[model samples]
Target: MLQNEQEYIRILRSRLEGTMPHEELDDYLSDYREHFRIGKANGKTDGELWQSLGSPDNVAREIRVTHLVKKAEGNRSARNIFHAAFATLGLGLFNLVFVLVPFILLVVMLLMIFIVGVLFAIIGPVAFVFSLLQGGLPAFSSWISPLIGFFFCTGMTTFGLLMVIGDYYLARFFYHVGIQYLKWNISVITGTECSA
Candidate 1:
């Protein structure tokens, strides 16, 4: 039996706290008032009609919750896309670093290893000549020196490959973890229930 439309809008605004669209709030209040009038014609009091529609607080809470859930879902989609793009960027950067720097480093390291191996090969012959002249136990063990150089070069090559693979996998794992953390935080913050 509310006579004034403005009074009804004021009550709804106080309850909704500016969360719902103003036009929608106006429509909903108009509908509720019409329904209340119908209930009044059917012998219900204003209090009875209000109670049947639900507590104003509960109605407001439901509207707020629905709006927030939709907003959260929209935000979640945006964040997912953003995180995916960022992760792709991170992976791209990781690939660029590993491919360019490691490729260059591997080439330099191999060149250095080749130079050292050649020096060792030359040293073996030089030591052999010196040993023959000095009559000392072959200054460099002829068989052992080449074997040591070969194994050292092989180990360095293996280690360089492993480091590149490890870098790729580590970057992938951290990017996935970071995306999951962002998703979890968004859900927690946006899923909070509004008080009635």
Candidate 2:
């Protein structure tokens, strides 16, 4: 179906209006209007400009991803990044393999490490108490001296804290890297332009 200038703007507005701030939405619309005005001045029709820019839906999808990615970067929140990643996935089916699978694996790995860190942090104090009590934990009290156990528990707690801290830094690193990758993917790997 052929789209006129009005149809193109309408489609973009419909898809993206609620998802971003009004100023941003107006900026996008203004840019498209400029493109149309320039094209028309050069003796090109609305259809030609629309075709060059690609279908409004695909273009809107790109805009949404860009908006969400910027939000993620600005806020550094997991929810924002997650929304951006999923929006990137919407650009094409190949992203199911290229983006989603790796994202899931990375998230699971991070979560596992976090859980292990928390378990160690909790167990250290529990084991410390057992090691000190009269009827302490059977295995630890039987073989370990109280002073040694105290040191061991302290070491365990410290290691856990370090792990937790490391995990946080690692997550930040991944988040930064992921945002860059998503920017590249949306521009180079996904449909930066489309036809209608």
Candidate 3:
């Protein structure tokens, strides 16, 4: 019985020294000891009991593989979720930069130009009519009215275009930064050693 217990202790120690978790090690050893005790009671010698349990290295390897498989599956699930979220957010940002922001800015610029043009168009005829009514001269006597409207529309269009370009580049910069951040975070989580 002493020899049987000593052999069990040796196997347990070696297995525990490996990457196996403490709870699993304890459970495996407890079950094996119980089996050994039963075999001893049934007239089997300590050597026979140890042999029946098979090679300690093989048993340890099996337990380690099981744990590693579980760990791998969990890591895979976490990685998938992480990747999905990153993809969604990146795409959303891309759309906002390349589509939504430019579209909205262009619409606003167009609306402003349209409103200004309409205002000038309305006021031009009214001023010309009032000037004719006054029998003196044009109150806003100038061909400069239409020219001002044209320049205003052109300036707003140019500004909106420049703003769209700036937004696009900024969005691209943010996308790259976000990607780098995610990569760094993943490396940290996975215990990867980053150089420099």
Candidate 1: tens digits of C-alpha lDDT, residues 1-196: 5534344445666765555467876777777778877878898877666666676656665655566555545677765444334333443464466345755675565456556555555555555445455454253444445445445545555555555555556556756765565455334333332332
Off by over 4 Å in 2: 1-7, 10-90, 135-137, 141-143, 189-196
Could you tell me how far off, in angstroms, the CA of residue 111 lies in candidate 1 after the best superposition?
70
Q: Tell how far residue 19 is off in model 2, in angstroms.
A: 21
Rank candidates by TM-score, best first: 2, 3, 1
Global lDDT of each model?
0.55, 0.80, 0.57
Tens digit of lDDT per residue, candidate 2, span 48-143?
888899999989888988888888799987766767776776745767788898899999999999999988888888888876785444565466
Give candidate 3's error at residue 178 in angstroms.
Answer: 34
Cα lDDT for residue 194, model 1? 33
Per-residue CA lDDT of candidate 3, range 127-178, in tens? 4445455543343345446545445545555555555555566566766765
TM-score of each: 0.33, 0.55, 0.35
Using TM-score as the measure, the top candidate is: 2
Preferred candidate (lDDT higher): 2 or 3: 2
| Candidate order, lDDT descending | 2, 3, 1
Candidate 1 has its poorest 10 consecutive residues by lDDT at 187-196
